[model samples]
Target chain A: MRVLIPIDGSECSKAAVDYIKERPWNKDDSFLLVHVVEPIPVDIGIAYIPAAYTPDEGAAFTQSEALLQVVLGDLKSVLTNQIDTKVIAGPAKAEIVDLAQEWKADLIVMGSHGRKGFNRLLLGSVTEDVMKSAPCSVTIVKSAHCSKSE
Target chain B: MLLNLLSAPKTNLRSLTNMKILISLDSSSSSQRAIDFALSRPWAEDDEFLIVSVVDVDRGDMSMASAMTSPNKTFNSEAERIVSEAKELLHNYLPQHKLETRCLSGPIKQAIIECAKNWSADLILLGSQGRQGLNRLVLGSIAEEVLRDAPCSVQIVRRKFSRREDQS
Candidate 1:
């Protein structure tokens, strides 16, 4: 089984990681951790954008990369298996759903606050979009503890 | 057929509370897929399963409710049969565990959420019809609503497509 998990380093995102820790696993099953970095507006340095990279965009990419490493490190300590990690930049909902399909993930596990930007936005919940569009099963972990109810 | 641990790796056996699971059921094939998926999972020994089927009924008129009550009573009987059959099917699979079945009358999403909340369910399993794009938005979905306001976690299970369906 191939599982895809999207995280954003929020409390709920860590909770999702915790939730996965409590579940059972199989030997051949692998994990793909995805972190989507929302694109920063290019307006900050548009005059210099046409040449090299803008400062704002460069800063944003660096931040997202650091977060991905932190999350992967935390997961590596808890899990003893083959785990793959990827960091992409795009709209949170579209990127997550697209990656799950492209990777042929058997399941997509997302946390309550895993979406980028504000949790609930005008475009609809990012988690909800992934749930609706992903090519496989989707499990939304609200509370870190599976036994706990909201 | 049996491997080691898949993705969700850990098995925290310390918290030994009986897991309350609410599975939203219907007469659709997708719902059966959800049940099959749940049954195939390696649940804890103390896990308790609750199968609930909701009969969507308008609040305006209880006596003339669409699915809950009909002049010929077809919908009411079918709803009861579905839930009862599900209970029996599940019993055959996991007879040692505790199980309960209920037929609720109300809006599909509201009824399922209410049952899950009252039961203090640890998890909810729902079947997605796999409707796409405009259709989903126009008709909405019970699974969507329950996911937003559920008392606990929710899993949306989809039916596995057959080889013949894949070609199309």
Candidate 2:
């Protein structure tokens, strides 16, 4: 089976990695670990603070790339040999679905905050969007256990 | 509303040997994938499988209401049609496994959650459309809501299939 796991550098996302590690997967199964970097809102950058320290368009692009590399490095450390990693830039839910379709992954395993009521309504979960739109099977690992430590 | 029921303390695991599993059905490839995944697992011998198809009354009013309320020979005929199709599909895939089928009326997500709680299902499995972009943002996904509030563990299946690439 081909599985796609999306990580956001959150411990909840890492829980998915741990779940797979504990499972008894066949040698034939392959995994793709994906991380999506949402495009930085240009307005936020322009609106904030010191004009001297503010980066130009080219400099901002470079900074985003650097940030992506750092996040990918963290992902690489936890991912086992069984998993392959891909880092892309876009909205988390859309990019994840696109990658799943491109790879023809049989399953998508990711983490959920398990938000409820007003919080869920306001936050609008990415896990929810992925569940609605994924072309393959999806497994959502709720991070209730992670919240306890916080 | 169903969240209250789900939040109730979990039943003893030791007494759950014969638990039921509700597999939500649609014509999507992802739904079929979920069925395949469930069958692949080693479930207890006494466990039951209930395949359910919910008719979303809110989506279409007259047609759905007529199908459910008509007492004549044509009563719930559309629902029956869907139930039959689901049964055929399930039987074709799981011929040996004993299965039960039901067609209920309500919102899809709410109906599925209620059925899971009513049946005390140990797990709920669903196949997602995997719709993305602006379309998905406007219309929320059922699989996501079920995952968050389901009384039991929920599995969302997407249709992506990957083959192992040999490293050697």
Candidate 3:
């Protein structure tokens, strides 16, 4: 089976990776690791700059690159041999579905936040969207051992 | 010949017990686990099994509403296709044993609870994605809800980790 795992570099996402690492997957099965980078609002960077210290486009680009490196590095360290990884720029939910379709993935493995009540309404969950939209099956991995602090 | 062996006067068919298992599937890996769990059991030939997939009514209605507003009317076709596909997926997995399926439309938790009640299932099995924080705050956990409200027992099967360090 071909599996697509969408990661956001959050602890919850890492928990998903951890869950997969512990599972007994078939030797022939392929795993794809996908990270979607939400488009950074250019206005935010422009808004924060002072008249005397204008934010350079080069600097912003460099900063984004550095952040991506850290996230990708952490992902690489956790992934096992033979797993394919890709970093794309788009909405997390939509990109995940797009990648799944592109890969013809048989399954999508992800982690859920386990939110409730008003908190859930205030912040819509991407896992929910992916679960509803994905062409194939999905698995949500919640961290059983980790508490709110860990 | 096998039937004759089983028909020996000493054998009691009444003594043979069949286990009842319930599988909740939604085109996910956890559904696969549910299937594997059911198949792995040392079930007698007469054992009964049920496979259920809950279609969220709110989601269906919301999509339908959105489609009505769309100018092209293309969303209607898309929605129909999706439902048809879901049904096909459900049918593909059914074989042997006593298999039944439902395409319920409503809140996932509510539909599941209703089904559990109507079926009087012995065990409700699910896969957990383990979403929490903001995501959980929004999407709600069907497994968690089922665990809390189901009339019968609930079993959550998580994905097996591939790494030794990650294992618990």
Best by DockQ: 1
Model 2, residue A133: distance off in Å is 4.5
Worst 10 residues of 3 chain B by lDDT: B1-10
For candidate 3 chain A, which ten residues in a row score worst on lDDT?
A114-123
Candidate 3: tens digits of C-alpha lDDT, residues B1-168: 111211223211122134344566665555455555443323445545666565543343344555556623443344344435533543454345565555555566787788777876655666553222126354337665665455544555544423331221
lDDT at B69, model 3: 68
User: Candidate 1 — which residues are off by over 4 angstroms?
Assistant: A41-66, A76-78, A115-119, A122-124, A144-150, B1-18, B58-73, B130-136, B161-168
Residue A13 C-alpha lDDT in model 1: 61
Which candidate ranks first by TM-score, i.e. highest? 1
In candidate 1, what are the lDDT values of residues B102-157, reduced to their tens digit? 88877778888899889888789887762221265632376777888886778888
RMSD of each: 7.3, 9.0, 17.2
Local distance difference test, each candidate: 0.68, 0.60, 0.53
lDDT of 2 by residue, B8-125 (tens): 3422332334556688875456566666566454455566788887665444334545555653324345556655776676666567666788887677778899998898776677
CA deviation > 4 Å runs, candidate 3: A41-81, A114-124, A145-150, B1-22, B25-168
List TM-scores of chain B, every candidate: 0.72, 0.65, 0.56
Supply candidate 1's per-residue lDDT for A78: 71
Summarize candidate 3's per-residue lDDT along A34-107 as a digit string, tens digits: 66656544655744433322223344334434444543454457544457766666667889999988987767
